[model samples]
Target: MNSSRRAQAIAPFHVMDILARARALEAQGRDIIHLEIGEPDFPTPAPVARAAIEAIENGELHYTPALGLPQLREAIAGFYRKRYGVEVPAARIAVTTGASGALLLALGALLDAGDEILMADPGYPCNRHFASFIDARPVAIPVGPDTAFQLTAQLVERHWTENTKAVLLASPSNPTGTLARDEEIRGIAAWCAKRGATLIVDEIYHGLVYEAPPQTALAQAEEIVVINSFSKYFHMTGWRLGWLAAPAGLLGGIERLAQNLFLAPPTPAQFAALAAFSEETAAILEARRQELKARRDFLLPALRELGFGLSVAPQGAFYLYADVSRFSGDSFVFAERLLEQAGVAITPGVDFGAVAPQRHVRFAYTRPLPVLQEAVARIRRFLAERRA
Candidate 1:
């Protein structure tokens, strides 16, 4: 069988591969501490789970409208209004299978073959691959701690080739957990608007911030679309649901594509997600957020003490991207040794991008306090033995 060029161009998700190996080890009775996954360790809020079960009992298991349940769309719109003080109309919201589906529709509709989209090098790989899936090239802009590991207006201006069609950004980004500031996002959005390009912001980790809350990009640029998911802060990873708030002009095309591609997102999941925004659910999620903060506070200093280079600490998300050149020149090799010797699993930066990948690794604090502590202890022992 022949695979398409698009399939070859898209890189495999390395973390999932690492996870599979870790699972293999666990099957052999190994006690592995998993810090490689990106999702929260928290359970779905009881209300949301209860909603799904109730909906099923009531036989609300049919396909939703192609754009999603109208009420769920309205709920998502209302969430932006209440949380970010931004008025997002329900008409502009398109619910899809997940953030993955939303990205597929957005990139597929907006880009033609050979079109270029700019994104941070050390970003969510899936974002870049979505462009490649549509035969659109994703230009990786190398970023560092100075830029908070986000694309800036200057980077956009510098990388604006004739074929550049759009910009993809993720704040409180994966791997680094670093955020793009509001002013910079505004400037970049303005640049894209002036150049007739589009800006797509991934806000899936929006509700998981440790410091101040993030300002919505929707508020920054009217022409931009916002991508968010139930997977991260809402603790609904397996539910595979998310929504996109596209500009009114782009919504029709995105909706039409959604009709053909997905028909609708999962009906039971849609009904359940209605409770995700409730006050009771918010309380449950906030408590878990505090726990994540505590884990970060403990692990950040612990890793530094253990001599991992963390020049700029993370502001959001459950990850800490560290420079491991001091310990090993190759992150993937070091990660394998760490897994085999210490039984602590993590993701190598090669999974994210080619920018200094050999020198970096990402640690996700998706485990509880005790589990994280145990992983740290094991890592400390592994480093000690390596030095000896």
Candidate 2:
């Protein structure tokens, strides 16, 4: 019995492996403070929870239409109109099991086997794997400090190949937490349009921005495929609900794939997510957003005081992708030591991409303030002792 070669080519999620290792240590009495995972520490808001409860009570837990409930689709479209002022019709939206599902649908619908899809280095690793799963080549365009670890139109032009069928990127990206500029996004859209390439934007971190709001590719072109989720800002990770807004013409192919691949996204999650858009949930989440902002403020200076050099002040996402080469070039070892000695868990950059894996580590500030403060204190002590 043999597994598919494609399955062998992809690696397991490195960050999650470390998280599991840390948890195992904790079971043996090590008090670990987790700053590794990207998930928010908050739970789903009360209104959203209540919506799920009502749906279950009303016996609405049955499987829905393959595309999803019409009301939920309409509500998602209205959300875009109100939130980003982007006019998207319900017919163009496909609710997915998660942003991961949306990515698979987009890749399966858009690319052929051996077709190339350009993505920035240090991007979310799953984007690359999703391409691999479909027998498509995920071409890594090395975007370094010069590009702020983001994909630009110039880089796209430099790397564009005849086989390149699409471009994928995340604003307020996963490992880097760097948000691509609106002008940069517009330029990429124009460049892709001219070359007949599809533009896929992952805006999952749109609402978690600090200092300024993140830009949506939908504002640049109506035909682009935009993937968003209720997981991040809405604190609904476990519910497993997300959506993809693609061109009206692409909807048919996407729907066909969804019908076969997923049947439909979870029914209760879709119904529950409606409340995530309500004014009441918005007010509740705004306070959580501000709390994340404060944690960012607190952690930035603390990390610097501990001598962690950061490339830039992350403007969105609750992460600090710090340069840890000053102390050691091996981030995996550094992360291990931080967890074992300091009782603090952080993610190694190798999980993101191979650009400069040994030199970087990412810390998520999505935990409670007290927990983050204690982790900072422990890290500071670890640094001081090493210096002494």
Candidate 3:
């Protein structure tokens, strides 16, 4: 028997392999400084944790509707109204296993086999895979620092083909951490509307913006499908809970797909996430967001001083997509050597996409200030030794 071609076609998420290698070295007593994964180092907020504990004690573990607990959906809707001043009805929200689930559902609902979804190169890898899982062509248009590592309305038009059916965007994108301008988002939405295509924006890192107030794509257009999660902003990665807001026209299909695919998101997690929008949880998350900003501030200069080429200071999320061409021509080899020689782990650019990937790497500032300081010091030493 042979594995299915679809299964074989998916490339490995290289960072996981890097993480495993880092762990192996740690087991042998090496001191490893991890700057690889995008996960926040903060614990889940006290209110959320308490809610989960209370739900468990109260035996609120039974499956709710496949779309999610009605109250939780209402809470998410209220969050949009209060935070972004955008009105999102609870009926349009579908909670899922995580942002991953939301992506799967959105792609599943929107894409047909042989259809095409346009996305940026150097984007979150799983997105491309999601399109592939359903036999859709994921067209990756290469973008660079000139556009702040984002896709613009012009780029979309230039790349559009007869097969293109949707456009997927990630503001405060995973590897680069750069956000699309609000006007550009509006422009893209307008273009999609003109072309009679769907627009899906991944707002998973919505709450972590630094340079400006966080804006929801829902503010730009209600028809836009917005994907969000408890993982990044709420510090609940392990809980595996997320939600998507679909326009009324897409909600029925999304709900039907959610019912068939997920049955329901984790019951206890939904109960716990109810507290995620509370004032108490907001304060905790705001403090952590500031801490993340501080980490980015600290590490950006430190890495530049160590001779890594970081042209753009990321405006959101906890990553710095760096040009490592001065140090090495290939990012994968550079990452491996850095891990083995410096005991520091960071993700290589190959994990993102194939546009000048050899010249780039992503540094996640998901560590404490002191740890990042140490990683910088080690990288400095590594560079000096390699030069000598």
**lDDT per residue as tens, model 2, 71-173:** 9899998988898888889999999988989999999999999999999988898999999899899999887767778999998888988999999989888
Q: Against the hidden true structure, what lDDT does model 2 obtain?
A: 0.89
Write the residue-wise lDDT of candidate 1 on 209-324 in tens digits: 89988788999889898899998899999999999999899988998898888888999999999999999999999999999999999999999999999989899999999999
Global lDDT of each model?
Answer: 0.91, 0.89, 0.92
TM-score of 2: 0.98
Clashes of 1: 0
Q: Deviation in angstroms for 353 in model 1?
A: 0.7
Positional deviation of 245 in candidate 1, in angstroms? 0.6
Provide TM-scores for the models.
0.98, 0.98, 0.99
RMSD of 2: 1.1
Model 1, position 178, has a per-residue lDDT of 90
- lDDT, residue 230, model 2: 88
lDDT of 3 by residue, 1-388 (tens): 8899999999998889899999999999999999998897899999999999999999999989999999999999999999999999999999999999999999999889999999999999999999999999999999998999888999999999888889999988989999988888898888988887888999998788888886898898767899999999999999999999998888888889989998999999999999999999999999999999999889989888878888888899999999999989899999999999999999999989989989988999999999999999899999999999
- Model 3, stretches more than 4 Å misplaced? none
**Which residue window of length 10 is worst by lDDT in model 3?**
214-223
Better of 1 and 3 by TM-score: 3
